[model samples]
Target: MKGVVISMIVVLAMIQFMVKPGQAISCGQVDASLAPCVPYLTGGGNPAPACCDGVKNIKGMAATTADRRAACNCVKDAANRYSNLKDDAAQALPAKCGVQMNIPISKSTNCDVIN
Candidate 1:
């Protein structure tokens, strides 16, 4: 009985370390943060100050690989909804907003591959 209890405790401890932490950001949060940038992404114009703020907010929110992947997936979904999204403009958005994204913002990017 003593050995069985000890083994169970060890297994539980190992499981704790094996579990990945949940992402801090949600898809809804990602959408809210990036919504301000839609105009610049679809049309040719400088990104608004609010848009840049949103970009910076997203960059700050994505602190882990899981968070980045979630954000990437959200961005891809949003991009897919916009038929007029300019690829070049979308790609340049981060830089234009003075934010550096770890993951590429495009429909083609595989969110699962991001680490």
Candidate 2:
């Protein structure tokens, strides 16, 4: 019985791991702050229309003209460096999204500036 219980526990743990956890969006569902692009940020979620709309409303980011250009190039470079469309497309994500990639949010606005 002891062995059986241990096996069952392990099975349960494996099942939980296999299950899709939840939305990958860190800022919550469709919030303006995250631009409804939470999924895109995780490279697994889909960008909500509201998120796209919010992207347009964001104000100035902390970046210089040169830094913006460099950030843009970095986005492209990251895209090429990563595998799969999700990872590559994430290169264009905003500051919030960039944070998920371990890149600083300050670098976020540059991708748009470069494009």
Candidate 3:
């Protein structure tokens, strides 16, 4: 069971590396870029400079519609990993970081809506 769980984690982690169709960014990039946003997104503290930097980085990575939606899904999945993650704060991070997200950051955001 333990090995199975670890394998599943590895698979999910690798999922971000697979670029399908017109996707411009990978989920791995999204994960790394948003690592600094945990405190603000989880409501543990205000957005730090590093967090804003990460937001800016994500803005650059998600350059295409497929990439934006992929990043959104990645972010949503990451947030869902945290039980206390706040939807409002997650939605507000982009604007707060001086970046505007083409797709909203809510967990309910449909990645397929990019078209």
Candidate 4:
């Protein structure tokens, strides 16, 4: 009985460590997923299939509020890195790709307000 109880406690502790809270996405992942979209965003043209795929991937990865906010911040940071990034193109990206994003991909967007 003592051994069984101890094993159960160990399992519970392991489960706690396995389930991390509020860190579903990282900036590196966001950057990788959205990198392909940069060219289209900078220069007006039909977004490539890879760009659209990246957009969709970003939407899918942002499952939780934290993830969404992180993605938003990362996108804003990435956009800032490119001075030529077009606002019109960024605004049109989600609709153009047929992907709905909770957080708009813009440098000016307030990530903290994304819920």
Those runs of model 2 whose alpha carbons end farther than 4 Å from true positions after fitting are 1-43, 46-62, 87-92, 95-115
lDDT of each: 0.78, 0.40, 0.74, 0.79
Error of 1 at 89 (Å): 0.3
**Which is better, 1 or 3, measured by lDDT?**
1
Can you give the lDDT of residue 43 in candidate 4?
A: 95
List the lowest-lDDT window of 10 residues for candidate 2: 23-32
Residue 24 in candidate 3, Cα distance off native in Å: 3.3
Q: Encode model 3's per-residue lDDT on 17-95: one tens digit a residue.
A: 5647455677676776676677788874578997888788778777877777778888778777888888888888888
- Error (Å) of candidate 2 at residue 87 is 7.2
Q: Give the TM-score of candidate 2.
A: 0.30
Considering every candidate listed, which one attains the maximal lDDT? 4
lDDT of 1: 0.78
Q: Write the per-residue lDDT of candidate 1 for residues 26-105, one digit (tens) a residue.
A: 66666666766778999958999978887887787788998899889988998998999999999889998888788677
| Candidate that would win on TM-score | 4
Quickly count the clashes in candidate 1. 0
Clashing pairs in 4: none
lDDT for position 17 in model 4 = 48
Better of 3 and 4 by lDDT: 4
**lDDT ranking, high to low:** 4, 1, 3, 2
